[model samples]
Target: MNLTYLPLFYDLSSREQRDALNELMARNPAIQLIDNILEQIQELVRVLFPSETIGEENLKQRVEVYLQNVDLATYGTWVYYPWLEKIVHLLNEEDFIRVRTSRNMYKIDQKEIATLGKKKIGVLGLSVGQSVALTLAMERTCGEIRLADFDHVELSNMNRLRCSITDLGINKAILAARQIAELDPYIKVRCYTDGATEDNLDDLLLVGGKLDLLVEECDGINMKILSRLKAKEFQIPVLMDTNDSGMLDMERFDLEPDRPILHGRLKVLEGLSSIAIAEQLRNLSFPEKIKYLSEMIGIENVSDAMKRSLPEMNKTIVGWPQLASSVMLGGAMITDVARRVLLGQLQSSGRFFVEFADLINDDPDKDFCRS
Candidate 1:
């Protein structure tokens, strides 16, 4: 993680350096406007685009002409990522609002987009949570987002997560943060590298002020319940999406503070504290945890292959199966629900499954396909 960009002009021939400078200027009209506004266009060009044959007077005239149509106030300072070194012109808030969300159109009105952009969101677990986090950023739904995941990117995660091979072994939380940074620099990103636990749960949930919403998708059953407890305590809404069968759970503690966590689905978790739950599973072997996870997520909710493979974990396979389609769909659906919840248009508290079975089972052409 080197975060520095140093252009080595000394390595290039004078002609090549000049050509590079010309290319840079051609690509960034924002810098030209900045130079013109400061009345240092000539000096700036001379400093950065030095040439033996081109006189100072000639350079000044050329730069001044190039900046005639450039709008100085429409953009601010140029920024480049330390690692990638790609320069980007910062846009004014109004211009940014228009350009970043131009495709949202009539679906999300400008007022709603503006409102959503100011809200803060938190996402736990980066495997499937990565999609949800990125989707939220894509919609410009939340201006500030916090991500928590202690796991590193493994080759196995590529099945559902959208990342290249180069991302292997990187911290999932940081990977998500970096991707979000590259997508929208205006979005403030925070990551808890250690994942959510008693040590950092407060910071993640309440210390920096309660998050507008929490999206919990971690493998830790305790976190799944504990996070909801905290959300309920703070009267903050929480949303989660289990990729299988498009099962989505919305717990609007703000609307119904007394609502049972997970709609009281797992009776075993009714009165258990997170510490007690952790102690109960502390002695379980790795394979046992996998099998326990299958049960925790509801064995019936998973694909047949995943359910079948659970028993094979210690003897054959390493983990469960996940599909790119389900992960991506979880991302899109969670973001949609997050927006609705944030905008106060939805206040329901229950489970909703966006499964294809309903559609496929009801299809009038089903008999034709079967025949």
Candidate 2:
């Protein structure tokens, strides 16, 4: 089933766009038409005057004033989502963004939002990366997001991935792009279905203006190392979440151009050229890859449950186990850190954990009123 995720925008004022819209409607007579432009304009009016508390009649008057008494049907742009066979009417880009992100005011501030709108973020894997990408879109954290993943959705992935059952067998990267488009069609998205590799690494990081930040989540040990090498070469910061124990890795290659990838954990790969590193890692047995992965992520820092689960892989279990809770937490953590990093509010490189297991007390006998 071929599908296109990008939404098409039309300005009816233009004769060309008007004909295109007419042709689209004629071609797909069953397409769903959704026009909520009036409500959208009402919300936009409230956003424009956030300090005031206006009644429903007053709000309607304000909306009319803002629209200059223009007819609501022709006031804004028409966006069509081909995948869903639906067309929606909403305020144009600038006003839509302002109203959509109105609640982020002061917390993100107008200046910071503008800055974020100019930033581009790259995500290499879709398992946990989907959460990060969607979070970034919902928060309007960045203007463009690049996704790369060669894998397809499977029933087993439902435990952690936020995708519908109908998406099974769909490329993960494409699935994420579709989701992002459905949420906010304005955010730009590019998918690398081949996944990040030695050949595409440079293009992914440098092609469309070097990525401001790279979130590396792919499972391949080689790509993990190679992607960072490319990011370091381009002086781009990297962020990663292991989807376990709330572990997050931030490599400020932008701030410290000389910093070793993964904090020098995989020293075996230090001296080899990118090609040699790929070849060498490609020949490693499954056990060897796991060994290197443990070293890279610090086996000592792994949670007790994960350490136990690792030994049962391909035996009692299929592969590494990940929970929905951990994946959600990872998404939140990475997005928060990403916003801070992009805004220049955070500048450091190291591993951090927001371990819920450590923060909560399970003891039933603890005092109730202690300070």
Best by TM-score: 2
- The TM-score between candidate 2 and the true structure equals 0.96
> What is the model-wide C-alpha lDDT for candidate 2?
0.89
TM-score each candidate.
Answer: 0.76, 0.96
- lDDT over C-alpha atoms for residue 107 of model 2: 94
CA lDDT, candidate 1, residue 2:
28
> How many angstroms is residue 19 displaced in model 2 relative to the true structure, after the best TM-score fit?
0.6
* Tens-place lDDT digits, model 2, residues 1-371: 45466789989878899899999999999999998788888888888887899899999789768878576666788989887899989788898889888889889999999999999999999998999999999999999999999988999999988888989989899999999988888899998988997888888888878899999999888788888888888899999999887899999999999999999998888888867877887767889989899989998789999989888989999967899899898989999999999999999999998887666666556535235
Listed per candidate, the RMSD to the true structure in angstroms reads 10.2, 1.8
Q: 1-371, model 1: which lDDT tens digit per residue?
A: 42221212211224565466557657764443212323433444444443445576777677777558775533243444544545554443454556668668569988998898889999999999999999999999998899999998999899888889988888888888888877777787888888887668778877666789999988876677677777888888999988887889898999999887777666766787767865775556776665556655666777665667767866787655677888898999999999999999998988888876654575776765454
| Whole-model lDDT values for every prediction | 0.75, 0.89
